[model samples]
Target: MTATGSATLHIDAPRQRVRAVLLDALSLPSWNPAFVSLAGPAVVALGTAYRITVRPGLKGTLAYEAMDLDMVRMAWQVPGFAETGDWRLVASGDRTLVHHDFTHAGPIAAVLRQAYEGVAELRLGRLAQVLHS
Candidate 1:
């Protein structure tokens, strides 16, 4: 079975600014605690690949590759995993609404769903702060 989750955050910044921050993979560890580091080629367009190391538990790291970045639509996918998601950016006035939808598969889908939601909220909060500042 698979589980799906979606979250949105309204950022007090222009769509371009929000997208810039989100695509800056190198700066991820600066604001996100779960990300240890990002390795691989530079970010291009959709299908560009990058490696990421994320903390899965107390002392383990889960390595995965991310690809398919639709910069124009502000969307992407984290391939090579049982989960896939897309980030949609909607510009409203001077702010941008970031909508994220993710689906997880496998037996640990429930646990991953909870973890992803919590992580997404935290990341969104951090992104909002950075954009506002």
Candidate 2:
């Protein structure tokens, strides 16, 4: 948790729907950044470690650390980096205010600091597209 970045997205969907999308590990590539593939349980479970390919060659390990109606948190590690990703959901009528934030430690985290904002925007944009579809 040496470096951090966050982005908020308003999706025209209920919190339940938005929460489902966030926990769908197998479908994350459709919106998540640098996420090439997932190799583990199709359904995420707390403490169930899974392997993921950040790119075609780069790999990582991730697990669901916490989950509830309002937020889902994950613990991720790749090479010299370790991170906690939190997707906080706020419900407003028929919409969900998704505040995505991540704190990371290690060299990789520091290196990504300069590009974190752009990356977050890219990911959130893709997510919005998917939810809208």
Candidate 3:
């Protein structure tokens, strides 16, 4: 079975600034500790493929390819499990609303749901700090 989750955070930064951080693959690890490494082009674009590794030690090398991107949204494909994720940013006054949506199949589903339920708030706090920094 596939389990899914969504998380939203409000950052003091502007939407464009938050969106920039979300779109930058190189900066992913700084905010999201689950990411071990993202090997891809220095500049990420739609259709760009990346070799991704995750924490809690997931087995096997996970492959991801950018699916689509817009000014405030980006989606990617996890080809290994046929899963996908999306991030979106919306402007609210001077703040930005950041949202993340994820899906996972099989055992990974339980892991993801557990992670979100356990430390999602803490993770969002870290994400806000990263955006502020």
Descending-lDDT candidate ranking: 2, 3, 1
- On lDDT, the candidate that comes out on top is 2
- Candidate 2 TM-score, C-alpha based: 0.90
Q: Given candidate 1, what's the lDDT at residue 84?
A: 58
The predicted structure with the larger lDDT, 1 or 2, is 2
Flag clash pairs in model 1. 47-68
Residue-level lDDT of model 3, residues 1-133, one tens digit each, is 6666677888898877766676677777777777777777776666666676666544333333442333333333342343456656678889977676666665555555565553445555776898777
Candidate closest to the true structure, highest TM-score: 2
Worst window of 10 by summed lDDT in candidate 1:
68-77
lDDT of each: 0.60, 0.81, 0.61
Which segments of model 2 are wrong by more than 4 Å?
Answer: none
Candidate 3 runs further than 4 Å off: 56-83, 110-112, 118-123
lDDT of 1 by residue, 6-121 (tens): 67888888888877776666676678776666654455445454556655532222222333232232222233235555567788889888876666665556556556656556
Q: Model 1 residue 98 lDDT?
A: 81
For each predicted model, how many residue pairs clash, with residues at least 3 apart or on different chains? 1, 0, 0
CA error at residue 62 for candidate 2, angstroms: 1.1
Q: Kindly list the per-residue Cα lDDT of model 2 for residues 89-129, writing each as its tens digit.
A: 99999998888888889887787777676555566677778
